[model samples]
Structure formats: C-alpha cells, structure tokens
Target: MKYVVGLLLALACLQAQATEEQTVVLISIDGFRHDYIELHGAPNIAKIAEQGVRSEGLIPVYPSKTFPNHISIVTGQYPSNHGIVDNNFYDTERKQRYKMGDGVKDSTWLTTLPIWNLAEFQGVKAATFFWPESEARINGRTPSYYFNYSTPAPNRQRIDQIVEWLKLPEAARPRLVTGYFSIVDTMGHRFGPESHQVAKAVKHVDELIGELWQRIHDETEVPVNLILVSDHGMSQITAKDMIDVKELNIDEELFEIVNASTRLMIYPKEDVSADQIQQLEQRLKQKQGNFVIESEQQLAQLGVTDGPRKPAIVLGTTAPATFTTRPEEQRKDGGTHGFHSSRDMDGLFVAAGPAIQQGTQINRFSNIHIYPFMAKLLELELMTEIDGDAEVLTPIIR
Candidate 1:
C-alpha cells in the first residue's frame, strides 16, 4: 500500500510540473473569415496550420456578432446563456441598456464563468489584453492581469507585454493569455470584405502574429500553445443589400428599435397596446420582405429566446444582405457579420503547439467549445458546469 501511494505521489508531482511547463495563448482576430487565410498569403498562420491543428471554420453562435460570440467562446455558453446577446441590447427586465463600451460596470449582466475566472480559482495565473469583458470583475473575479481596451497601443507593444508576462517567474507567470485585434473587422466594416483595405489589414495582422510567434519561440522557456480564433466572418454589403426600416412607415412611437445590424431586434414601447405591437410586427415583416421574422419558437430555434434581453421581434436577413433601423446612417458599401454561421460567415480557428496534433483538419466546429479546450490546456478545474462539449476537441488537441 505504501509503495502504491508513493507511486501516485510521484506521478502527481510530474503532472503538476508538466502543467507548469506549458502555456496557452488564445488570440482573436475580429472579422477573420475562414477563407481569409486562403485568399491572403499569411505564411506564419499557414505554417501553423501546416504543422498544427487547423479547423476549416469556427461556426459562431446565432446572431454571429462580436461581443456575443467572443463571450460565448470564453464562457462555453450561447449568447442567450452568457447574457451578451448583441453589441448593443436593451435589457427589458432591468430597464437598462447594455452596450459594447459599457465596460464591466455591472457584473449582474453576465451569468456564466469565463475561462480567466476558472483559471484563477484553480491556482493558475491568467492574463488578457483587450479581450471583451476582460476588464470587468464579473462574479467578483477578474484575470490576474488585464488591460482595458486601449486604441493607441501598437500591436508590437501588446505582443511585448505578453512576452514580458511569459518571462515572469513561475509563481508570477500567467499560464493563459488572450489578445484581440480589431483592425481587420474595422477595415471590413469601412471597406467591403473583398476590398484592398481588408486585405491590407489581414496582411498587417499576420505580420504582427508572425512577430508574436517568433517572440514566443525566442523569449519564453516554457512550451507555448498558440490558438488563433475570430469571433465571426464578414460578408460584403451595399446600399442595394440593406433593408431600410423607415420604408415601412410604421408609427415609431409604438415600438423602439433596440439594436440593428444584419440582425434586427425591436421592442414595443412599455405602454403600447398589444394591438399596436401586433401591427408594428406585421409592418416590419412586410417592409423587410427578405428577412425572416422570428416567432418565439423560431427565436428559441435560433438560440435567441432564452434570455430576458431578447427583443419582441427578431429579424434575420439572408446572406449578403442587412436590415437597418437607421437607414440614413447606414454606409453605402462595406461588410458586416451578425448573420447565421454558415459558409462565408463562419470564422477562423488554428492551433499550434507542442501538444496539438499536426496537420489535422476539423471541417467545422462551434466556438463555445473553446472554453473546454482552454480549461484542459491550462490544467485548470472548471468549477462551473458549462455548455461546451470539450470532448469534441480531444482528437485534435491530443
């Protein structure tokens, strides 16, 4: 019995040492279409794909928007469960509005545990650089180190900071680090997805990634696992593709537009009569002929009805199209996401590290599963039960 106990102790020590030797870095490139890699010559990213695990695409959760999808990826829950349903949403229950820039001012909005919180609880130090919601101490626990979203910080500076963190003593070092790049999404929004500007942004981001890859290899003694992801892909749009809500000529006083993008959501005015709300819903559907007006059942099917913040009516446009409440404010030509996660709207995911399988290709997978992957890589216990099925990634990660 003593001999067996001694062997178990020896194995546990080796396991802990192994955990300390590995690092996991998750990088999110906003609006990085799965095909951007194929369209652009991103040698560093391609090299990682060639040598490590590569997914054909990462399918985002419904509404396929930024904050919702990014939050979903970390929390291992759908936007409905995680409580960030859109870039901007009106919380009907709280009578408050939640915007992307709201920061972590209200912890009550989120209902799930992000990976950083899990890491800290399990005695693993973690850090984040501009990852959505990283700044807020949700559930009264934030990452060990995090930076607010700063626009002026250069990509090189951000990478340097991460490298410095990695170089810290084991006790002080963070095993998990997350970084974000929004330039690609910015260019894709200003220009179209196929525009030269987006291409340029992609190349620039790739160069920054290459620099980060090299720095990690040169600067850190620990073996690092790099996981690259994007919230959702961008789709081209034009004036012709937009469905203008004003064209409907409905009484604006009867209802309120909660948020509008490719995905449209609206709420009836609090004092509005049920008959008035019914009329507004019909008018919206008639005006936006191309959009699918979602009923409560359909909203549930699309994973949008489970939250209190869900609007009274939801509009989902077919691809290459958008619905806008403020048509006057809409740009003439550019790109947008927030579409169903299919084909061109699917995002990107690639992993390269000592432990990741080589040249493996996952045809497609959901982004929510990423939380489980992070948990396993960091050797942290997932204290909260999450919706992500971590086993889906076991094949590639091993």
Candidate 2:
C-alpha cells in the first residue's frame, strides 16, 4: 500500500510539473473558410499545417455566427449554454435584447466555465487579446491579462502587442493566450468570399500571423502551443441575395438583426404569439427563399442552441448566396455566415506546436470541441467536462 501511495504522489508531482511546462496560444482568424489555407492565399496557415495538425473543417457552433461560436471556443459550451445565441437576439424571458456588445457584461449570465476561468482555478495564467466578450470581467474576475475589442486598431499592432505580452516577466507571463483577427470577416462582409477583396484580406491576415509567429518562436524561452482557429466560415454574396427587411414589415418587436447578413435574431411582439411568429418565419422564408428556419428548440438539439435571451427563430441563408441589409444604395451585395454547420458552412481549424501531429486532417469537429484539443495541448484540466464533447486530438499528439 505504501508503494502504491508513493507512486500516486510521484505521479501528482510529475503532472504538476508537466502543466507548468505547457503554453497555449490561440489565434482566432475570423471568417476563415476551410479553403483559405488551401486556396494559396494563406501561406502562413499552410505552413502551420506543415508543422502541426490540420483539419478539413472545424464545424462551428450552431447559428454559425461570430459571437456565439467565438464564445463557444473558450467556454466549451454551445450557444444554448454560453448564452450568445446569435450576434444579437431578443431574450423571450428577459424581455430584453442581448447583442454581442454590452450583452455579456455580466459573467454570471454564462453558465459554463470559460477556459481562462478554469485555468485560473488550476493556478495557470491566461490572457485574451481581442477575443469577443473579453473587454470586461465576468463575475468580477478576468483573465490574467486582456485587451478589449479595439476595432480600428491595426492588425500589425495587435500582433505586436500579443508578441510583446508573451515577453512579459515570469510573474506577468500568461500560460495561455488567445488572439483575434477580424479582417477576413470584415472583408467578407464588404465583398463576397470569392471576390478579390476577400482574397486580399486573407493574404493580409496571413502575413500578420506570420509576423506574430516569428516573434513567438524567436522571443519566448518556453516552447508554446499555438491554435489557429476561426469562429465560422464565410459565404459569397451578391446584390441579388440581399434582403430588404423594410419590405417584410419586420417586427422590430419580433426580430432585431445586428450582424444583418450572416445571422438574425428573431423575436415576436407581445409574448409568445404563435400565429404571428409562424407568419414571421413564413415571411422570412418567402423573402429569403429556401433558408432554413430554426426555432430555439431545434437549434439546441443541433448542438449550437442559444440561451433564454435568444429570439424565437433563427434562419440560415442556404442558397449559393449570402445575406446583407442596405436601404438606399444597392440594398445588397455582401457575404456572411450564421448558416447551419453543413458543408456550405465549414470553418477553419489548425494546430501547430510541439505536441501536434503533422500532415493530417482532424475530422469535422465544432469550435466548442476545441477546448479538449486546447486543454490537451497546454496540459490543463478542464473546468468541467460538461461544456461540449471534444476529442483530445491524440492524432496530433505523439
């Protein structure tokens, strides 16, 4: 018995040492379509694959929008659990609306434990550089360090900042870090995915990533694990696919769309009116034509269901098109996501580091499942195994 006890203590000490040696860096590239890396535009991303694990696609959480999916990546929970149903949604119960902006100020609204919070509990320090909802502390606790969404800040600046943060003193250093790049998604919104504009954005972000990586490899003493991921994939759009919400007499009471093109938040005026809500869904179907209409309940079962604050129904722009809203001008012409997690909505995920497997593809896994992959990479204990199901990515780890 003493021998067994001694072995257990030895293993515990070894485990703690292993955790201390690990470092994880998460790079979230927005609107990173699965093809971006393979399309010859994102060479840096391709290089990451050469060095580590690559996936055919990283399925996004349901709703397949920015806020919901991005939140899912850190919390390991679906929108239903993390509470960001869409970029913006009206809470049927709260009788209030929640946008990605001020909606997440209260950390308690989130049911699942975020990766940063979990890392804190384990004595690991974590940081977020421009990740969504990172601007403020939740439950009066924030990451070891954080940078809010400074949209106008240049990408180079953001990259430099992250590189600089990694070089902080040992006491100030973070064991895990997450960063964001929104140019691709921003460009996708301005021009369709196939447009030359998007190609340029992809190239630009790729270079930014390359610069950021050179610094990480050159500066950091401890080897770091990097995860390059995206919240959702992008879809091409044309002026033809644009929807004129004014034409539908949309219920500002029923639906409030923040992201406009990729996703929508639907609410019915005057408490749970079934007939009106059905009509609203039908109206959207007529206007958009062939888009998938997902009620809150259906979305939950699909693995990306949102919280109580979400609207009545969510729609996916399914055609070989996109979504946009403009009143006076063309009233159209933009790309978007927020579609279902089908082949059309496939996103990006790539892992490169000491532990990652090289020259291979991970099966279709959602961003929520990224937690297990990250936990394994950085060697951290999950807050609780209940956020979502994610494989530990043994394929990448030797």
Candidate 3:
C-alpha cells in the first residue's frame, strides 16, 4: 500500500511539471508600423523575427485606431461585434459617451471576452502589465495579476514585474502574460511618423524588449513563447488638411458629431426624421472636401454592424486629412491613424519561442485572428464563438 501511494504522488508531480513547461508572453508596442523594424532598426526584434516567425504585416480592422484594434487582437472580434467602435463614441441607448482612458473600468460596454479572461476561466492563470480594458472585470473575471492603466509607470518596471510573475512557484505562476508600451505611439503622434523622434522612440523600445528577452531566456525555468504586435501604424497629417463639419452649414441640433481624426461618426438627434437625416447626408455630399460619406453597404463591408452605437452616417478620408469642429484653431502637424485599412495603417507581428517555427514568414492577416492563435498556445479552449480562426495562424505553430 505504501509503495502504491508513493507511485501515485510521483505521477501527480509529473503532470504538474508537464503543465508548467509552456508559457506565452504577449507584448504590444503601440504604433509600431510594419516597416518600423527595417526603417528604425530594431536589432533585437529583428533577431526574434529571424529566429522565429514574422509577417509581412498585420492588417488592422477598419478605422485603424488604438483601442479598437488592441481589443480586436485580444477578443478576436471586430469593433462592431466588440462594442468599442472607436476610442471615443457615443452610445445613444445608454445616453453615455465613452472616452479612451475613462471608460475602461466599465465592462458593460464590452460584448466579448478577452484572451486573459478566457485563460483564467479555463483554470490557467494570467497576468497583464497593461492592455486596453485589462483592468476591467469582464464577466466577473480579471487577470490574477494586473495593474490599473497608468502612463506614469516606467516601461522597464513593467517588464521587471512580468519577469517576477514568471519566477513564482509553479502553482502560483501565471502561464499567460501581457505587456504594453506606448512610447512609440506617443512619439509618432507628437512628431510625424518620419521624424527623428519616432525613430529614437523605436530604438528605445527595442532595447527594452531585448532586455526582457534576455532575462526570460536566462532566468526562467519555464520556456517562454514571445508574441509581439502593434495596434496600428501612423501617417503624417497637417493642419491644412483638416476638414471642419461646420463648413457644411448644417443645423447643429440635427446630429451629434464624433470626430475620430480620419473619420467622423454622425448620430442623428432623437427627434430628427429620416428625411431630415437624408437631407443632412445630401448636404455633406454636396460640400465634401477631403472626405466621403460612407453608405450602409460600405459600413457593412468594413465590419460595422447596425446598432445604437453605430452612427447614421460615416465620413471617411483616404488622404492625410482629419475631421474637426474647430476650424479656426489650426491643428498641430503630426502623425495620426484611425484611417481605413491601407498600407499606411498596417501594424507588426512577430512570434518566437519553443512553440513557434523558426525563420518563417507569413502573409498579412487580420488582427482578429491573433486571439485564437494565442489561445492555442496557452492550450485553452475558447468559451464562446469568436471571429478569429486559429487555422489562419496554425501553420506557424510548431
């Protein structure tokens, strides 16, 4: 009997050890364009690509904005399905407005579960240094280790925390970890994408990533799989290209406008009639400058579903232009995104580790597919239907 009990305990220890063998570390470098690696020179990231898998580009969802794309990458759902149509939008049903940093605590706005939430639900622990809505409790589940979003936190500190989490005991350690850096995006927005400042920011981030990579490779007992990505790219836009809706001479009471840099969402007032809305659309068409009115069919093609959050009309621009309400005030000359998916809006994707194939390059794919790919790495089953299909990225997995 004593021998049999000892054998059972040994088997249990083996199972635990097997489970601790794999770890997935997801990192997001906000606004790291697809060409940034070659243009800005990131030797560490380039080395990772050379060692593992790299993509030509990672296609962002329509209106390639930060919050929406980041959420899409983790949730595997488009903005239309996830309920965060843009960084800032008005929900007519709730009579509430959502602004980037302010609305993250409210989980009611989200319709799908992020990969972190899914991991915890499936008995695998997860940790997040920072990610959009990572601090929120979605469906009553939050990552085991997470910090409230704060720009004041140092990038190196965040990386150090992730290393600490990986060093915990097997039972307490999180198998899934996520980290985010905003310096690249911030530089791109303040200085133009082509400016020297942006290149310097990229270099700074690449060095930090290198430090993290070295520490993980040297210190951790568990093998780590690193996946790096970005929300979207940046494009230069000047104040001269700004289009003010007030120039249309429409009644302000007829609709509420949400200006999203390259796009504008117009939601008609409650009392506005269908004919009045048609008239407004006609006026916008007549006075169209650098923007074009998006029809219902066009919206659908872009994965924008009909809902209270969906605007009555969308004004989009293909050029380096922005929609604004204050035309009198000249806007700053810098970089911006939220444009329709184009070469300028393409982001980055890189994966390296035990579970990834070395020296593999794949074609451009949508960011929505990343969630399922990460889910596959963590060996977690998705609880609900998601737009992402793991099959798209299965070829890169070992």
Top-scoring candidate (TM-score): 3
Stretches of model 2 off by over 4 angstroms after superposition: 1-20, 249-265, 271-288, 295-300, 304-307, 320-325, 390-392
TM-score of each: 0.91, 0.85, 0.93
Clashes of each: 0, 5, 0
Q: Any idea what lDDT model 3 has?
A: 0.89
Instruction: State in Å the error of residue 346, model 1.
Output: 0.8
lDDT for each of the candidates?
A: 0.83, 0.73, 0.89
Candidate 3 deviates by what RMSD?
A: 5.6
List all candidate RMSDs to the true structure: 5.1, 6.0, 5.6
Q: lDDT tens string, model 2, 1-398? A: 99999999987864664455767889898888888766637888788787878888888877788888888898888777777766766666666766676634665555666788778777888888888887556656678888767788777877887787788887878878888989888888787777788889899988988877778889876667778888888776666656554565675755555444555556565665788878777777776564566655666677654445656666656645444556547665667787667765788888776555667776777677787767766667775655665454655764
Structure candidate 3, residue pairs in collision: none
Candidate 1, TM-score vs. the true structure? 0.91
lDDT of 2: 0.73
Extract clashing residue pairs from model 1. none
Put down candidate 1 lDDT per residue, 267-291, tens digits, no spaces.
Answer: 6667878887777777766665678
After aligning candidate 1 to the native by TM-score, how far in Å is the CA of 385 from where it should be? 2.8
Better of 1 and 2 by lDDT: 1
lDDT of 1 at 299: 69
